[model samples]
Target: MRVKKQKRNRRTVKFFSACFGFREPFKVICDGTFIHHLLAHRLLPADDALAKLLGARVTLFSSRCITAELKSLGQSHSESLEASLQLIPASCDHEKRVNAAACIESIIAEGNGKHFFVATQDIELRRRLREVPSVPVIYGLKNSLLIEQPSTAQREFVKCSEEKRLHASVSEIQILRKEVNETDQGRDSFDPDQSSRTRTLKRSLDSTEKSKFKRKRAKGPNPLSCKKKKSKEVSIPSPNKEGSVPAKKRKRTRKKKDSGLEQGSGS
Candidate 1:
């Protein structure tokens, strides 16, 4: 049983601490059995596992199924179990174990390990939760409670995975930006008229080449060319040629007459 003075003293300290902005408390999802065990064994004050590790006390949470189980316990255990239920700061009203697991999984998934813990004695549940990286478990050891620190490798793995994801996202953004810039450049330099003119010029060149090839093929040696005879050129004389004077004789006679006239004049 808690003394009234101690309770009042705690309340006073809490009230003052709240006003002064005290340290944040760790968040712990717990089962009813662990709570009853701590209270019954008078070990709650001495355990201090979370405080030692986190430098702060914890705010407890549980599922409604745990609360119901505590309520249904025999009368012999009712008072202590009831007191334990009251000690929990919040209870998730989901009835199934799966629901509780799901809720705790989400909290762990946040990757804020220093602020969250899971307290339970269920062996199967502990095994399953341990599979999640960086999840700490608090369970009973001997007459006191202890916190099982998360595996170092698990923490490192989670850190590396997060870094890889961030790198991949950043690289993806860079690639997308590069693509967008290239697209913008292409658009800025594009000329529709130039492209169309280029296509027309190419078509004309191709047509000219095709026509040249067809002409060469047609001009190739024909089969009849080998059998054809060559034609000879023949000159024909004119009928009026008998009365025409020769060009050389006319020049000689004109030169002789000029010479005779010069002699007669001289004489």
Candidate 2:
């Protein structure tokens, strides 16, 4: 009976252990924003509470972008009061930073002698940290901490890209197949030049339908040409009519009475 009771107790302990994460608190990879926000919001007491729970001073890494962005507002040293932090410079380039982060996590592991938690605003970094078999990543979400395994897919960021492509070419091909299957005869009468020719044909057909025939009157010869012909005929004058004699005007009339009287008296 004691042996059975001992086995049950062991099972119960294992169940509770699996359900609870960071029950006594552990390590962290701290994000600057998370820490600074705690400071700005006057959550310094909470920071002390967390640090006490973890049994160590919080660690900070230098992300140049994060620092430059925050430095614009003159808040580079904003988290000084939260906990004693160590700044390790970080890279924005993913592969470069992942290796760097892995190195840091490994070093911290040696000092702490176990998997210390990683805190960051970068999901990609979190995933990379998770892949390390020794260094499990612990993330700060809102007010709590979540520990999870790394993602297999690495991440990249693109800004305002027109060439963003996916491996989803198969879906496009599937859509084409569905349309083509619906009408196999669509290819038979397919006219590639149809759009270009349509406007030209429409214009020509409209002109032909609207055209009307008109029989025009022939134009007469110009008046100046007729006047010129008359002037030429006048220049070539005919025989003069005044010089010619009529037959009746040609014969002479004698003094017949006077001659008759003298002949009669002489006789």
Candidate 3:
């Protein structure tokens, strides 16, 4: 089924200034492309969530890529992103580094001595904002806001904290599938997590075994492991085995549906 398009109207700094910062009525520049993106796809800075975070007088711009992504997200989503975009198209063609620097400079210039803030999830923008030796600005997302000079250390700390929290939440959410000893309140607290679990090297393994072992509990892609995906072994029924079906085909019925239940009866 085709989804219906939803449209949102243009917003300004006057609307959300007080929503994110310590004070109200601040001059803020939002990344419309970012908004388009958050709304068009998945990730943080959720569309409706971010909208409620901004004010009416807000100015918005987007990276050429983000703008393209939004406009191409199709008419409905594009309209949603355009509501707060201020529709200022940013130049990202050629000289990527230069254009990015100029974009931030232009935003700062526009602020012109009043309290101005730049809101984005872009790392490079965050870096440039931190490196510049001038006015104070704030960085934010939905519901939470912070002001800083875009220091890597600060960013790293924030990133680590978020990841740690997500890991804990994920573990707590799945805790019931494994442990029976955990109390309901203990489960609710979300203390120790699988992410927090680290292993000590008890003994050195032989190279052949280490290289051949296919099961790994680590998260994400990692190099240096001398391992290749092993082709699935075909399990055959033993001649002496009784009552076991062949490893391949077993029960057969048509009109298969999902894990919930079969809608139609079968012979």
Candidate 4:
């Protein structure tokens, strides 16, 4: 298949898997027309062709009603009947044989809880299947097989379900509020004595914690900013013997020779 076609098929498969709970080894229900188309187009071995188109392993299925309807078409559709017989038979719970389209629709029902992918060439059957949520339809286009994109109904259904999940309804909100109020009332009606004891304990614990971590007082002036005090040095005299005299003072005498020299000059 071309890359673009393969990518589109993968995206469709992913959407079904994520939103509709489709898993690996996908289940497919083959109707009479699809089987006939496969034989007519030389696309024999329905399982492999479907597996390749789906990008996963697939188990081909056919209901008893589909096989019976194909048989009723006579030997012209012998090969298609043989191909349909080879597939696993799905239970339609119908005693009487029905049209292939109706049989397939019955199998899919409302939600397609079986997660069956319907492979058919009938345009009307495909249209009907699209209206039902979570049913993926596969159709053959000439030599290539194609999976249809999610239909409007399927997309709208997914959108609505997602909205419901994301936003609670008024009734749901009221139920939640009622639960919360009930829990609150239960708490308020609990033992009052124990509650008072708990409150007092909490207060005492807070006070003790506060006292344990006392706030520091503003510090005194920084020692680095204070002036250093000057130290006084005291001089002590050396001790002398008790009888020893203290140091005496020495006096200088003036000479009379100057006066004598003056008298001699005068004479």
How do these models rank on TM-score, best leading?
4, 1, 2, 3
Number of the top candidate by TM-score? 4
TM-score of candidate 3 relative to the true fold: 0.29
Please list the Cα RMSD from the true structure of every candidate, rounded to 1 decimal place.
26.7, 27.5, 32.6, 12.0
Q: For residues 1-267, write the lDDT of model 1, one tens digit per residue.
A: 335434543453343233322346756667666776666677655237445434457676665655566667778668556655565545343445444455555555645343456777777778877666545677776564565544555557657876886675777989999999999888679798867898999999999989888743346677776786789989554445587644443544443457878899999
* Candidate models: Cα lDDT each: 0.61, 0.48, 0.47, 0.90
Candidate 2 TM-score, true structure as reference:
0.29
Candidate 4 C-alpha lDDT tens digits along 1-267: 499999999999999999999998999998899989888888867788999999999999999999999899999999888888888999897888889888888888868889999999898888888888899999999888999999989999999999999999999999999999999998899998978998999999999999999989999999999999999999655546885656655778876678878999999
Would you list the rank order by lDDT, best first?
4, 1, 2, 3
Model 3 per-residue lDDT tens digits across residues 1-267: 111111111122322232223234334545543454455454344433434444223434455544444465686765655654444554445343333335545646533344455656566776756644333344444434434433454356446766886666666768765566566556667656532542222223455567788686768766676588799999666753676664655777687578445544442
Question: Which ranges in model 4 have alpha carbons more than 4 Å from their true place?
Answer: 169-171, 184-267
Candidate 2: where is the Cα deviation over 4 Å? 1-25, 29-31, 40-42, 46-77, 80-114, 149-267
Residue pairs clashing, model 1 = none
lDDT winner between 2 and 4, please give it.
Answer: 4
Pull out the clashing pairs in model 4.
none
Alpha carbon lDDT at 125, candidate 1 = 70
Q: What TM-scores do the predictions have?
A: 0.47, 0.29, 0.29, 0.70
Task: Name the regions of candidate 3 deviating beyond 4 angstroms.
Answer: 1-24, 37-80, 85-101, 109-115, 135-137, 140-143, 149-267
Model 4 clash count equals: 0
